[model samples]
Target: MINNVRRDLNDLPQSLRNYLGVALGGAGLVFWVIAVRESHFLNMNAYGLVSILGWPFFVGLALVAAAFTVELFRAPLRSMQLTILIVLLVLFVFGTPCAVEPVASLTSSWVHAGFIQYIVQHGHALNGYDARFSWPGGFSMGAVLVAFAGQANAIGFLRWFPLFIELSYLAPLLVIARSSGVSRRAGWLGVALFYSTNWIYQDYFSPQALNYLFFLVIIAAVFACWQPKPLASYGPQSGFWRPRLHQNRNLLTRSRWEGLDTTSTWTSAATLWVLGLIGIIMLASSMSHQLTPYVLILALGACLLTRRLGRPEMVLMITVLAFGWLSLGASDYWVGHLNVIFGSAFQVSSTIGSNVTGRLLGGLSHVLIVETRILLTGGLFLLAGVGFLRRSADSRALEVLAGVPFLVLIAQSYGGEGLQRVVLFGLPFTGLLAASAIFPLRTGAIKAILPAFSFGRFARFAKPTVRMAAFVVVLGFALATTVVRGGNDSYESFSKGEFDAVNFAYNHVRPGQTIESVNGYLPVGFRGIGSVSVTTPAQRSSTSVRRVGLRLLRDRPSEIILSQSQQLFGEEVSGYPVGWEASLESTLVNHGYIITAQWRTATVLALTG
Candidate 1:
């Protein structure tokens, strides 16, 4: 039966195989759409990826992955294009259909859109609007695009922006993977692993997302200008270095420290042009994001250390640009609050305790999802380690690239998201090394074949069976990581009704009227620029809730708004227990506040005499 299946498979035309692959992938997408469309958000598991439709989706992914592996091995030339399409299908097709209203995935998406709305309407960043606005390049760019498109506001773009940003990453990532010294097969698998394991939601429409693209593009360009040596050239060389005491005499001398330089694709003049282009990108990134510039600087330093980059002056130039932007353009954010900038530097324990350990306090389902996420990340690193051991000669580029981002971990907490940012910045490189684990560069025709194991008496069947198994592994990781990445959507995402309630409140509130909530999860301040004063105390602890309400009452706010989304957010991410919202409501009622308006998802309480 197996022999017959193989014969039948080999007899089919490549066109038929490609068509079958697309058909299977499309069927999976359809199943996912039907499942999400028919199901309600409340019914989602801890991870949003699982539903009655997930099984079919998994089967579909299996078929698609199988198609990718088969086509890659059989017809290596056109495999990348097909594989990229498959990647887009996996990363985007499931999510794009539901992009209109905010998903339970993130509240920041709405908040970011609000920033763009502010920029578009007023043509200026509001003073003390938020720290993100201090570097308003990305928001301003969004504003320009929105204005050019003649859109009413930036809200419509939020749902689909993640997909767009993720797809945009493919080209640069492929370039980086291909030229980073890995073989052709490793490069393809690396790119695929990147999409599969990228559960980080940094691809949302924000400064980080935009700056991350700049980061990738810059790295890709640099690596392109100086591609790594072929696998054979990585062998040892016998060179006499200067005496140990003289080594420190001139640290800038590359020839004395390392061997002869390899040929770069770009001439010295073109290299200068690339460096100038990189400087401009770094400047723009500096204006757009607070963290990515530093990330870029550190990554460039890593490239220099590996001898993959020749321009050492480029590093110092980027540093000046980043710090210059912080001093001049973003002075509003850190001028008086210098402590916030430097307080957590080197305070790794405190940073972790607050950023990581604190957020781990959640319900069982949330805990499970978080643990799964940790395991998934750790598993990737472990694979990279194995790949490092298995193929030591051809991994220096990936290793240095992957390891450099850890420098960010030591610098600052990025307001508890530092680790996440680090993982995201390193993902493209780490994914490359991780792929080397499954498909280490081989010497001959078998170089195309991915790594797979066989048991006793079945070794002869390993080639075909292992190919199918490898695809299965890839598909499984993609599906599981998708579930873990988006699992929090049940509580984190908002509904259109929720947005309507917030919009209605904004329209009704007059300028200077205080709009207060115990938590800032609702879509507020997106429409009304300087029209109202909205306050949600940064700390939303149960003890602080009453204090915030009393404080708002003291200030004589025009309206107090609360919503089901806020309540859920507090319970889930904020560590508030159940019934916290009701208690606050009871407190409001006792203070002579009347319910002026109510929606299924939100409520407005007006202060009465």
Candidate 2:
């Protein structure tokens, strides 16, 4: 293998290098699957990120990253094949193998599948169903696709959907990174970093995941079409502000005067096509997800401010579409819940406290995982700051893009989960700038940092070693992410028996009969959204399990579910003590609720009046 690598390195055939690159990546993926196959989902933890996957997977990832880095630096050509493989391996290395039956890990994936199922069965979306169902563009799309694929429902898609959506993100991300004014090497590394440190779990089979792809594609289109031509620059004052009272024709006209000759019919037509495509994507995104359209609006606004986006009207159009859709199409969502929409508009600290600080209730290992997440996020921002200081690239596009997502905080709390979504939206840009901090595109920057190094004969030899070192650093982040990203899978993941128990209860219960759970972390209701109703009896913020148990008994829900995941969800989310579910179960038994069905991982009880 070493001899083959040396021969390839020496000869440097483009075809051979590309083939070798993919081969190495494929081998890495195989090694990763082999390593992960040995472990059970029950045994996984933050620590298992290192111990469970074994050395072979990490070694495989390292080889793959190294090969991609070498190919990118050496060839510097367009190749979707390599990028696609890298993205697949990055996303699915842990996910595809672990996406076993029972629809576990993330409880929300099942709910999303249910939403799709509802849409597929019925011709239209269920109005007043839920806030998420109101923005049912993604679910509708999923339903259409499922029907096209001859699938009855979206349940089969839930397990590997995160990996699928993440892999889908790679195409547009590469486009954004390449045009981000970073070198090819830095672009690839940035992509790696984006995947590596993505501990944010928004990639579940949800609207956000689908809408995020639209967001990336739209941004990539903007970057690809509206880049500042060589030596052509414009000021932000034109786009940023205008005199409303006074007749400022000059300012208005100047803002419209994006200094480029569009007399060429081809250029004009192509620009129109790109803008039209972006408009369509923006509309789709607006209809699909709530927070993302707002985020996209702000991101486009930032681009306008930075003069990267030419048509200032594009920003206005997007804003109108997003707000217009909310007002007319999704009126059911905000008509009664106006406070939920505008409550956290200005309460930034409160939002963070609720989303971040409130989630810290867990075991020692869980707490450590959360802390590590904080550190990783902070470290990325710090590196972004360093990138700003370093200025590895000629354009400040990435810097502006990185800063724009911060403004999303002031818009809404997104039900206290806004900050988490903020991290995810900012990650792609942050990863780019962060990569620049480490593997600078300009050789001159490297010389500046390592001043004693000779830039003459030894530079050739030194460059490969530096790239390898950068690869190792990126691998470290990936490994860390693999650990914390799904660290909660121990209690979070459901079993097949849990699914069977829920299915049995669903089969027995009639429509409109309420099925109550302490938490929604168990896999249920995905196949019976319209046929059955599910509710969580306990307030997520309430810490008293006894009070919750009393509420359940008093309400006398028609049916009840208690799953292992629900127990852990109670302990983790509400800070309930271990065996709180058991305590609640005992109370229910004493209250004349009889266990109608039981599975190894779950139980169903009926209220007998």
Candidate 3:
């Protein structure tokens, strides 16, 4: 029966196949629109966006994945059709949250907006205000944009920034994928996989998002500018054994090293110009985000070691710039918090524990989401390993690039998000390698490093099996990503009511007065900079409502803003009892607090005279 279906599909005319692909993408878009219209943020539960998202969203995602897979398998692939399908898939995966939510999500996005606003208003970063402000290039750039657009603040740019930035990433990603020494089909599929599996929420409006763009552009430039020179095989013909010291020395001789060096067709002037641009981007990245510069250094070093980079000086330039900014420009951040900077260096176990184990403690739904993330990451790496064994390539550059990001895990944990960042930095290469498992080249510029595993009898059914595998893998990732990507939206995503309440508090509160909340999940910081302060007490499930009220009373904050998102966070993540916010609000009212303002999803309480 499967063979018959495959035969029928193969018999379809090229025009009909193209139409089918277009139809699938159109249907997927329609379903996605329906899903967005059907979704209600207020209805979201512990399962996060998935809880509120209906079947249409999943159907839409599946359709888009199917369309891409079908296009991927077609003879003489339709690049335009595949591009449209991938864009639709990206929309389904990344743009849904922006479309469904009332306002821009994530507290850090709002804070970053606040930083940009401060820069726009004052023309300088507020000193000693925020650790993030010490590296202010992104915020400064945003301020320039705001001025260029004649916008009063950065709020106008926040809501759809993720979608815009993600779409922007696709260009560099395409360059990287196409130039990464993979088959054209594998490169396109790898690009799709990169988007499908990118559940990391760092694309929100922040320095990291912009720096990530810089990261991609730098790597893409390197790949486009250089290709590895062909070298003779020196390793064992079979089995996993190390080469002898003499063979290794022979491999490293001046002639051999020259053979290993990368070559470029571009003129030296063009190469120097591109390198200078890359340097500027590195400088900007170093001043924009603390971590990406080091990641770039590591990536450049990986390229250099793997003979994919023509210029070795690029790595040193980034390293010096990254640390130089740390010592000079960002002194305010690391001056006193040196331990925070280097506290976890070489503490691999502790870093892993913090990055992985610490994140596992939450509600069942949250735990499931985290587990899915881990599984997705592990699954990609596992597939990449198979590809590495099966693939024929000129250089082991992809393998090195994919593996080198892990070294960042040993240096600093990046506040428990290091692992996620590592996964992201390596995702393009990892996706390519994983795709190679499905569509590996027969041969390349150099002999295979490892003996290629033969499919043997399975080779007869390879085409259909490869199609099915690609479809399953892409669709499975799309579905899983839909769940895990928005898994925190129950608390992380804000509603209009929450926004209104936060605005009310900010407007009514004085410059020196503090606004208190149970958590920092809402849109609170865009308006207030150095003058107004907001505080969220440490969340503890053991703490009673009475104790929370007592702490509020002791702190005597001028106003307290409690919202549905914060309450959901307490119940879902902190393990606090459901309606704990209400209980605490009642306790505060009974003492001396009055409900100064109220909204359907949020309330602001003020102390009564």
Candidate 4:
């Protein structure tokens, strides 16, 4: 049967096969468009985007994965066809939310827009306003973009920012994949897997997103510029019979260090220029984000230890820049909030509890999403480990690069998001290793670190079976990614009505007045920075309508905006009863609050005298 399948595949002309790949890619995109058009935001339920996404989405994803797998096995890979398929897959995975939703998701993205607006209007960052402002490099850059684009504010950039930045990541990703001691097939597969499994929502319109690009570019440059020298072989008489300590000493000798040193074919001037560019990027990263610089430091140290990085001083430079900014430039953030900065240092147990166990507090559907994420991450790492064992390479740089990010957890937890950030930092390398599991190289630039594992006995069965297996695996991950990636869209994504309601509230509410919501899930922060205060039930102990009404009556906010997204968060995540917002609205009306404005998806209540 397998032979028949192989013969059938081989019978097709090369041009026909190329045309077929393109046709499948186009069909997948068409199906995705149909899926997006059919999806209704109101239909989304506790299962999040999967509840609203139709069958066409899955069909589209499967076809794209199949096309990619077919291209992977072609005799001479058509780079153009592979590129088209990969981009289409990226669109299906990362661009779906951008297209289906009426407004950009994430209140934080909206808040970031507001920060950019502040910089554009005030000619500088607002001091003593936000901890994020202390790291104002990205915002400053956004301000420039806003002015250059002739846009009044950064709001216009919010809706499609996630997709744009994710697409931008592909350039550096290509470099890293091709240079990181992997076969061409594994490199391409790793890139696809990276996009397929990237459920982390950090790619929104934020500093971290830009800083992440810097992270990738820096790593890519390092890998591209250098290759490790072959290690020298030791004779049995020299150290085979010596004490373990003596053997260890021999391993640490200056000659050994020279052997581990990396060499590059680039001219001296070019090397110097690349080093300078890396330093500038590191400096910018240090100023733009609190955590990425440190992550970069760890990644560079890993490379140095594994002999992939030739310059040890690069680590010192980034560390100094990161700390220098923290102490001198971002003093406002860490001075009074020292505990917020270093309180969780070395508290691995508590950090894990907060990052993992505490996050499992939502409803069953949410629990399923979180559990799926955990399992997917664990499964990817396990595959990477298997790849490490199966593949033969000169250095273990990929393994070290993927593993060292965990060390960040010991230093600081980054407000329980430490693990997620760790995963993000390690994801590219992990994807490479995972791809090696499926399509490993038998030899590289130097002696193999491990004996190459052979599947020669099953070679006949392997091609057909492995192709099908690869297709299934990629298809499964794409499907699962579509589910968990948008699993929070129930509350995270907003509608046109919600956006309009928040705009209405912002325009009417005066300075010193307060705006309140059932929760912090609404799109409310794109305007009204320090002048108008906003509050949510996130800190409240009870979410009961009566309890919430009592608290609101006492506070007497000038205006309150309630939206569908916030309501869904109350019901789905906080486990409040369905229609809880309606009951809360009634309770507010019974008091001094009057319905001043209303939309299909949102409402505004004014505190009437």
Candidate 5:
């Protein structure tokens, strides 16, 4: 009877259906299927430490959910600005505690926001630290955003900032996806699942999530430009002089089983305007001698292979590729390497490995699966791609969708060659891979065409018993994972105890009082503090660390960790293979730094006078 009711409600208007989805999603958040068995009273101290990060993350994300909900009620792009205002309100009221992280990473946007940070914090932009470039004559958006974040921190704008930034990605994605005939539900679900995937951790969770949020809008300009000259859709006169704003609606209009009636002059013109704007951005990226052009280049290539490339694509592709070929590597090195082999005409890059550039390839071994693993993971993607191909859906869309993962492979292999390498390579790949799975999860056009139908039949809403059972299953799963990972509450971030040490170090130390951790905790712990240490990976010999510490700290560190349970009890540090356990033990004993409090694996030390 309940299933019958849910089927009946499925045909409700999207606004009503979406509201229902939000309520159900909220319920899922509250009563997920995996957690259960422990009383709520089990971890009392943890409730107190909620301020450390978790609740803020959930709240901030909840605000994001609210913002998406607002977007859902409004159809198309007619009322974007007003919807954004509503989104802003939700964040300010509900999400406030996420501001604690910026103090550590110097998470300002001004530097990353512009040329000043490029020149000062990192000097290589002038002479191409990542590549061999000159000054960044072009605009510096990252530097600007960093500066804004710094300002936001001062004025206590942390809560709304995350929501603002996340929506940057959300808005454009909605505009594009909805216009393209994809269901609003699928589009929102696509962005949510893709953005929240494990692979997006570096972006969505980090300060850089801002960049990921805004970048596609920037890239979309290129796509807009590449679209074909606008033809008319409605009538004879309607086909002329149209702005590209409405152009995408051509490709994105929701269709029944019948195919679209093509070629409208006004509609085409508007679509091309959008495409043209994208093209201009692409050209500008090429001209800037910055990361955008390279990204545009690789993106364009993949775009072409997937059929996303349109008429303007040919000219854009050729021009960028030619300019890129000219600017690659220093003239002298390329000439010398090439002259040595093919009389100077065959200019090749000076790299350590033949196919994989040595510097770039260095990181590949870390992520690169050997033949067996490659065949497995890559094969899965390839098979997924094949399945996508077999679908009779829009060939171009499928092609573009499949090509995103392929592009990641290219970047992962050869083109992770610039400062924007992470943005250039990582962002699109994660989004593409995540979005690709949507097709696989709800297979077949018939089912994909249907909306989610929980509000069916006599039991339009779930019975309390059903809800409780679902809740227990989800609660149990979450509890099980938490237990397996050694009760590490945060599956995504460092624990409260780990974060606590930084505040402990910061407040405890006097201004200008020097400190050191024999282990290189400098980056995470001493964000705003003035300090120095010579901790390098290669020279971290037991003797070298103590000597370096003693020399740098000018005698002995007033405070040091002779033993601090290897960064997270048993979890692995960024690059190191061993968890906290394999952290250096002998090196601490050799140093005069005396152990004080020994809690679990942590041992705080203070130097003896």
Candidate 6:
């Protein structure tokens, strides 16, 4: 009978096999939505040539192959786990295979965010600074972080699937969910559902999504109100700080960590400090420009509230503050210019505050408060509390509560990194809340079986190696997708101006031309390679970086130049008075600069006379 069954299995068609592989992978993707995570296997390199270009497809294939063989290359997946693995492979091939380049994407986003619009157009990065005017995407640390894993990660595999961010966020949640009565079978299913549904957005916005992932793991530390991590699994505490939420008890005694203490070699502390510094700097450079007030408030709050933030955390905070301020000093936009924004903020502070408050109240009423973003964020954790209360928990749900602080910040600064980024930090919990939704919504027929509270024991089912491999594969996919997509669309639109301008400038610059300009370059200042550059702006023009055409107006510079955003200063020139017409002719003759080309998306009019 066994031989007959084996023969029957062998008779399946090749198409069927391929279909099964992808089918299972898609199921795995859905499973991620149910639990806001990924837990399965795929023969990542199953496809040969395709593996070189689209590794996410290959990784999914590899998982499927491993499942059939029953050998633990990473870890053997259970039958259900194998089903989910195959499905993701299908999705990657048919759905997410196309990609774009990097510089173009970063440049486009910078422009959309209203940053360095005119300057980045004509600027190129040389070492740390832009010699031309502005380096939109240079090789500096800021550039590196942006190009390689800031929001639009360009760094190889990590950005391919946002792995670093996902692994960090999901692992702790998975561990926590299992402890809170998620059966080994059910808990694993939840993870699969979570990944497929919510977190896919990370492929586009890294900082908002990644930071939230980090925030979720920290929140899980709160569930440990009593001993047992989540009510009775036992063991030493994990993470640097045994960070209890505002009023929680010290469930894990220090003595419990003796084994961890041994592994806590001196090198670990120094390593952590160094890593913290780098991470903070990267965060500051990539996203922390306006220096949100919340950061200052959070730092103080964190210092006072959490015991986990020992001397080391203090050191990290100080490091972040000092370095962040220094970056401000270095940039052209912020140096002595912050008063413009704050002054405006202070003026309408009351009105903006009122508008934001109304939105928050409206969101609370609908339960769809996070439709656009945080509410829309992929990974989230549902407190096992609802289940514990009902005697049988259902799916995980979003904590509308966290949105309060975020809503409050809209009055000060509007979009992106300001308050939205910080509010987004709470979004990873969506998965946890999702799990609660999965098990038992008393209203749904599905709930009859999936009890609300299982009180399941905490189990470390996935070993470190398994986790590490899974993380690598997920991140690899997210990073790759981001690089390709951000490029094809964004770059061209953002730099259409600068690219044209550079070509014209090269053709126009003469060996001994004296150029006068009403406005200076971005990232500020330029040296004369062949044309003497007079950097200044508006009416108050000086020869140095301060004034574009001032010194030239007094003396006879062979030519004059004019740019938008600053005043037309060279009204008085050799042939005539430096009004708009003389300013134009003078700049054309003197700087050898003329408007050669123009674009709708960018202000870049290629100039060469």
Deviation in Å, model 5, residue 258 alpha carbon: 29
Would you list the clashing residue pairs of candidate 3?
A: none
Which pairs, if any, clash in model 1? 47-487, 48-487, 103-493, 104-489, 104-493
1-609: candidate 6 lDDT, tens digit per residue? 534543564577755654554454454444433322221211112121122334434454444333322211213335444434523432442233222121122222221222222222323332222221222322233334444453432223321333334445556555544543344333443454344333233332233343344334333432221112122223555543342121133324452222111122235566466446544543443343333323323432332232222233333454565455445433554455655344445434553444343333221212132232233232232232333233232211123323334543533554323443443433333333444443333442112333333424523332333333333433333333323322222111122233344334434555564433344321111123223343333433223322333444454443333322122112211112324443443544465444444432212222342
Q: How close is candidate 1 to the true structure, as a TM-score?
A: 0.87
Candidate 6: give its CA RMSD in angstroms: 15.1
Residue pairs with backbone atoms closer than 3 Å in model 2 (clashes): none
Q: Per-residue lDDT for 22 in model 6?
A: 49
**Model 4 spans with C-alpha error above 4 angstroms:** 236-260, 444-458, 540-546
Candidate 2: list runs displaced more than 4 Å. Answer: 1-23, 44-56, 69-85, 92-104, 230-253, 256-266, 392-394, 442-465, 572-575
Of the candidates numbered 1 and 2, which has the greater TM-score value?
A: 1
Global Cα lDDT for candidate 3? 0.86
Error of 6 at 376 (Å): 4.5
lDDT of 4 by residue, 314-423 (tens): 98999999999999999988887799888998999999988899778668988899999988888888888878876767667898899999999998888889999999
Model 2 C-alpha lDDT per residue in residues 496-593, reported as the tens digit of each score: 87888878878878888888888776787687787688888765646478778878888787889898777766666567887777888888999999
Error of 4 at 492 (Å): 0.4
Q: 5 or 6: which has the higher lDDT?
A: 5
Worst lDDT 10-window in candidate 3: 239-248
TM-score of each: 0.87, 0.86, 0.95, 0.95, 0.50, 0.40
- Candidate 2 differs from the real structure by a C-alpha RMSD in angstroms, to one decimal, of 5.6
Which residue ranges in model 1 land beyond 4 Å of their true spot?
1-8, 11-15, 45-54, 80-84, 90-105, 229-253, 256-260, 267-273, 392-395, 442-458, 541-556, 573-583
lDDT (Cα, 0-100) at 3 in candidate 2: 49
Worst 10 residues of 5 by lDDT: 32-41
Candidate order by lDDT, highest to lowest?
A: 3, 4, 2, 1, 5, 6
